[model samples]
Target: MSLTVDIQFKRSSKIYHQGPISLINQSVEVTKSGKIPPGQTEIPFELPLSPRSSSKTLYETYHGLYVIVQYSLRCDIKRSLLAKDVSKLQEFIVEYRPSNGETDEKKAVKFEIRPETLQNVRDRARIPQFLVRGHLDSAVFPLSKPLTGELTVCECERGISSIELQLVRVETCGSAEGHTKEASEIQNIQIGEGDVCRGMAIPVYMVFPRLFTCATTIAPNFKIEFELSIVIIFDNDHLVVETFPIKLTRN
Candidate 1:
């Protein structure tokens, strides 16, 4: 039997990120005869989790639209010429160890969305008068905790069709020569539908998805960042967006 651990990095067609690096590859002898008997057999083995060299470092496993980090194990069984070789591959997750660093004070953010605060408006007179008030409990969030906040529609001349919270992942991959950055939506959750009541507080809550997200990472060659967008769609299908950049940590 053999064990192998490989880390693969790939780029999209439009010159993104590409490369597959092997961290560990080793052959292990499980049986004296190098053969297995009939029906059912159980074998137990243990291997140290370490990189092949001192220079190589393991990164957290992440699945993104254009960039991905993955760790996998493979076991191969050799057979006679009459039979074909058999192999099995299993994927595993890797994460950074939580640090005991000092915690930062939680900072709450208050925001108001008005027509004047909107951007890229071709004609301000076309937009209905509206006011929105909200606050995020904290600008920095731990991966294990849910994002909590509240928003209220203070006043609006036009009816609202829906209000949604969007989580976006901004992935940047490149080297010293250049880099490519792309933003993709990880999830969209609706907080309000139809005409919502004025002066009523609508709670904001979102759980960071597993595998699709990790602690905000910054490396020389790549970066994994996150942001949030609050989308409000009016009855006429016109929409306005407010974006917020957030920091993530493992506490």
Candidate 2:
């Protein structure tokens, strides 16, 4: 038997900030086992951001700018039919909150989701069938000025599963001229389960090229906008997977 999973985003939302700020919002929708069926499930989550009083504001002087926002999806499964054993699955949680007073416009932020954790749940649950899939919508926004810098993403743990990072895609746009470009670049890197039980970090780096030719338009005034997409596949009789979007800016 094969299990199927489906995910979706209701709306491509945008957030605005100025002078020390914290924002939290949900950016995706996830559904499993078809539209509406037995044992089917749907989960919604929020992305949180908090400002740091110690950090300097991006627009202390005032300017218009924007940063790309990314969303992540996570799932955990546990073995054992016993309520106590299965209940341990609840303890396996994935939390994503902003570190400090960092705005999407000031510096690019990288977000990671654990794959091993989810696989562990499946093993504990003793489920014979497994399947996972993720989907994201297409949308973009303009942010208030004084954009932050670029972001680098590194995965620390393989978590709970025996899956590999199969695909990664990146997209970028010129801030001053709005010249947009996108690339599917996951093949450039090698992804594997470093140490099944201990977990490992997958590193991803992105660089934005400068487009302006004249000095007048180059007073540290060029901006690079980016979008990152990723996909993962698990080792099982059926397919198990996860995915999300990330946005960043280069100063």
Candidate 3:
């Protein structure tokens, strides 16, 4: 028995905007002509993702609350002169494919805003600033699947008092030990304080928490994003908000 192989790339955070970050360490030997008096043996290798700072093509395999990139294969065995040396490991995933008229693959995230433009630019903010809009039939979801949406309140002259829907989890973490956290899940589609309704088609259902949901990722420091907010509560105080960017996949 004589073997040796090591191929690795694991980066959750190390910081690199573009140049100088390579850690796909490589090694191979694999029991050349020795370890098998039995059966089954096949070893082939190829690992090269070199000097890549451009030509962007691979990054889609994520588990994020920060970042997570993984791939590993380690095996070392030797049974010779005194015998005693063995190690084995396997944990792998490196997938990002799109090359036939490549559009770079990642679609389904629609956007449209103007719920007071997330309110805060008030200078006596008026002029049709409350007609809401929202739609998310699919923004990539399958964490036990239940997120239907459609909220189209065509006009609001500061009448509706309650209509809030928020399911947010935006986490960002840096490697020098920086930290940020956000978690939310609130639901109440519509409920006026007295009696209010301008134009309505509101129907939004929400169910999120497969295992505390996570599937958006980006690394350098770390990032996790998922948002869906539409709060148009105005019985006169006027608080209109809008946001959308969601992906809670485990598919």
Residue pairs clashing in model 1 are 11-17
Model 1 TM-score on a 0 to 1 scale: 0.89
lDDT by residue (tens digit), candidate 3, 43-99: 765556442344233443333333444445677776788879777877555543323
Tell me the whole-model lDDT of each prediction, alpha carbons only. 0.83, 0.29, 0.54
Best by TM-score: 1
Please give each candidate's TM-score.
Answer: 0.89, 0.23, 0.34
Ranking by lDDT: 1, 3, 2
**Winner on lDDT (2 vs 3):** 3
- Candidate 3 clashes: the total is 1
Model 1 lDDT, residue 100, Cα: 88
Model 1: residues >4 Å from true position, as ranges? 1-17, 23-27, 52-56, 122-125
Give per-residue CA lDDT, model 1, range 139-236, as digits (tens).
88998899989999999999999999999999887855567787999999999999999999999999999899998888656789999899999998
Descending-TM-score candidate ranking: 1, 3, 2
Q: Residue 143 CA error for candidate 3 (Å)? A: 4.0
